[model samples]
Target: MTETGDLSTAGAQNGHSCCAPATSRAEAVDSHVSHPGADPAVNSESEPEFSFDFVTAGGTFDMGDPFGDGHPADGEGPRHRVNLTEFEIATTSVTNDDFARFVADTGFVTTAERLGTSAVFAMLLETNPGAEAHILGQAPGVPWWVEVSGANWAAPEGPGSTIDNRRDHPVVHISWDDAQAYCAWSGTRLPSEAEWELAARGGLKGRRYPWGNRLLTDGEWNCNIWQGEFPRTNTLDDGFIGTAPARHFAPNGLGLFNTVGNVWEWCADWFTRDYYQHSPQSDPQGPDIGDKRIMRGGSFLCHDSYCNRYRVAARSSNTPDSSASNIGFRAVRKAH
Candidate 1:
C-alpha cells in the first residue's frame, strides 16, 4: 500500500485512490454550475417526517486493527483497550429520504450545492449519457474520479440524475459540514471516531468485520462491496455496483446495518495519524484540531486488491468541505 506522510493531506491534495475524491472548496468553485432549485416534491412542507432506529452501545472493547493489515500511514494499529459510556447510534446511515426532510425543514444548502460541483466516480459517467457534459475534469492523479457540475446530494450523478428512486440509499456527495448541518437540524451529532468504531464492532471484539473475521458468512456475502477487479469490472457479487440501500445487508450483532460498507460515514473527530498512540483510555475524542475529519467504513468501491478499508478498524479522512459520491454519514446521541 502506498503511504503518505499525512493520509488526509494526501487525499486532499490528490484524491483518494479507492474511495471518494477530495475536491477542495476552491477547486469546486472554479468550475461552478448554476444551483438548481430544490425539487418541490422533496422540499415541500408536506414531506414525511424522518426517524432513525438507534442501537444502544457502550462498554470496554479493543480498538484498532487486530490483524495488522491496515496501512501504517492510516494509523489503524497499536491495538488498545478503550472504555466508552453508553451512546446510541443509528442502525443504518442517513438516507436520501432522511436528508430530504432535513433540507425541507431547514432549507439548508449543502456545501456541494454552494460550491456547485461534486466528485463522482468516472465509471458511473460511462453508463450515464450526456453526463460527460457536466464534467469539470478528472481529479489530479486519480482519473477515476470525475468532478461534475451540479452533483450534489439531490443530483448524485450530475444535473439530470435524481434521488427519487434511491430514497433508501445513503445520501452521498455529503461533506462533513453538510452532515453537521443535518445533525444540528435533527438534534443529534456525528459519532466520535472512537464511538463509531465501538458501535461498528457491534458488541464484538477485535474482529475484522462486524459479523466476524471472515469476509463472507455461511457462504453468503454479508455486505456490499466491490466484487471484481479494481476500477475496471465489477461482478456485482454482492448485488450492488454503487451504494446499496442503507439497510440492505444483515445487521451486525448489535443490529447495525451496513456498518463497514455501503458508504464511508463521517465521524465527529478531526484526524491525526498518531492519535491512537496518545488516545485516552476512555472516550477518546481525537485530536484537538486538524484540517480533515475522520471517515470510517469503506464504501462500495472498496476492493481487497486496492482499498480494503472495509475492515472494522480501518479509517480514512478528507477535508471537512470535500464532498464525493462515496461519502455519507450517520448520527449519534447520548443513550438515555
Candidate 2:
C-alpha cells in the first residue's frame, strides 16, 4: 500500500525492483464465515468507524539486537538503525471487543471465519497425528505446523474452538485483509514495520526483550511470551497459557504491551527478508510488491527451543488471506 516510490525515471513506478526480490507469501487467503449466524459481509465501504489512542515515537532508535540468539531468521541480518519522525501508535493491540464493535456496526467477517479453517502451528493442535484427520498437514518448524480441519481464528483448534472464553484477549485468526478492514472501519491503519519496532522498543536500546534485556528482572513476567518447557507443557508463569489480555503484561518504555509475544501483529508492508540489505536510514517500509505480508511480535506459541520469534527484531511472513487463531492485529491512528 506504500504509494511513495521514486518517480525519477520514465517508468520507475513500474520498473523492476532494485532491491532483492521478496518471497511470495503475499497472497491473501480467504477465511470467509458461512456459519449459521456470525458476522455480516464486510467490504471497502463500511462505515461508523472506531477510534484508538496512540503514542508518538520520534527521533532514531536501534531496531535490532546487540547480541545474536538462537534461530535468528535470515531477514534479521545486517542489523541497522533508523531515525523516524514523530508518529503516534496505539498502545495496545486491537481487542476482541474492539473488533466486535466493528462487526456490530459494519458487519465485518474475519478471514478465519471466512476460511472455515486455517494453518495452525502443529504444536498447538491437540491431535497427535493418530487422531481423526481431515486435510491435516504440518509446516516445517520446531514443533512442526498442522493444517488441522476447522482451525480458524474463532475455534483456534477447529470446529470445537471458540473465542468465547477470551474477551480481553486480542482477537486472533485475522488475515491482512481482515485487519485492514478493521483498521479502515475503525479509522486507523496498520503500523509500518519501522514504526512498529520503534513503538515496541518503548524507547529502549540494546535490550533483549521489550521491558529490558532480561525476561524477568524482579522474579516476575514482563511480557506474555512463552512459559514453562517448550512443546510439552506451560506453567502459565506469565498468567497465561495461549494468550493474555492486550494489557496483561507491563508496557515497554513507550508504554506498549505485548510487543514481544502474544500474537503476530500484521504490518503495512509486504514481506522481504533481504529488504534490510538496502534499508534506508529513514523509515524503510519494505518492498513495494511481494506475495506475503510482514508479521512481527511472536505468539504465545513461541519458545526458545522452537519458535522464539518473539524477539523485538525477529520477523516472519504469511499470506495476506491466510488467518491463524494465533494471529491478531493492532492499529495506529495516523499522525497528523
Candidate 3:
C-alpha cells in the first residue's frame, strides 16, 4: 500500500515516508487536544502552568542529513551548518496529563474530535477486534493506518481503548493545529526544525542515533521504536509496542529525553524539500508558506527495516490539519 504524501518532501526510497512530496501549500497555520485521563489543576497564577523542565541549547551544528544512506527523499543531505540562537525546549513531548490540563481549562476541541475521527494502527485494531466496525478508511499505500471514528487522543484505539495509565506517555492523535493551541495556552510554541535538530543532537556532532551511531549499545535499547519487524510484528523488545512514558529512556547530552523516538514531534516549520537549499543560516524558520508542516524524530512505529526516520536529522510532514495515533509534539520557547 502506498500512503499518499502530505505537504512535505524528502528523498528516501522507503514507502514509510513522512518526508515524501506534499500536496499543495496552504495559507493558514495549524491548531492542538483530545487526550484521555484527567489532569491536575494548572494554575498559572500561583503554580507554574507548564511543569516540564527545559534544556537550553545554542551552537552551530550541521542540521541536514549528515550521512549518505539516509532517505534522500527526506532531503536530509546537503548537510549545512546552522548557527542557532539559544532556546529552551521541553525535556519531553507533551504528556497526556499535560494536554489533559489544557483541555480541562480551555475546553478546547482538537481537530480529531471536530472531525470525529483519527488514524489508528491496524495492529491496534486487531488487538481489539470490536473496533473494526469503526474503521473509516485506510491510508493509501499504508493499509495499516485505519482511519477510525472516535479515535481521538481520548480513545486512542477508536472506542474501546483508553489512556488510563498512559498519562505520562506522549499524547498522540494530535494535529499540528492542535499542538499550536496547546502551546498558545501554555505560553509556549513549537520548535523550528533547526532548533529541534540541535536539541536532538545533544551537543554531539554528526551522529546517527541521538545517543550515537549504535542503535543498540551494551544490549540495551536507547529509545522506543519498533523492535522485531515493521507493521507486521512488534517483538516489544523495547518494553513497549506503542508509546512509552515521555521519560522512559535516558536523556541526551542536553538532558532531553526521548527526542529520537516514541512519537513524531511536530515542528513549527512548513514542509518543503528544497527549504534547506536556501534556508537562513542563522535561526532559519522554514518556508514562508507551504501546504504541510514538519514532523521530526519518529514514532514507535519506526523501524530500521522500514522507517529509519528516528534519526536526529530525518524529517517528515503532514498537512496542518492531519492527526494520527503516532503523531504527538513537544514545545519550545526562546530564551529571554
Question: Count of backbone clashes for each model?
Answer: 0, 20, 21
Most accurate candidate by TM-score? 1
**How far off is residue 186 in model 1, in Å?**
0.5
Error of 2 at 292 (Å): 1.7
Candidate 3 lDDT by residue in tens digits, 182-262? 877776788889999999999889999789999999999999988876778889998987789999999999989999889
Which of 2 and 3 is the better model by lDDT?
3
Off by over 4 Å in 3: 1-48
Superposition error at 227 for model 1 (Å): 1.1
lDDT of 2 by residue, 12-45 (tens): 1221110011111323343342221112243436
The TM-scores, one per candidate, come to 0.89, 0.78, 0.88
CA shift of 297, model 1, Å: 0.3
Q: What is the model-wide C-alpha lDDT for candidate 2?
A: 0.64
Return the lDDT, model 1, position 294: 87
Instruction: For model 1, name the residue pairs that clash.
Output: none
Clashes of 2: 20
Worst 10 residues of 2 by lDDT: 15-24
Q: What is the lDDT of residue 291 in candidate 2?
A: 64
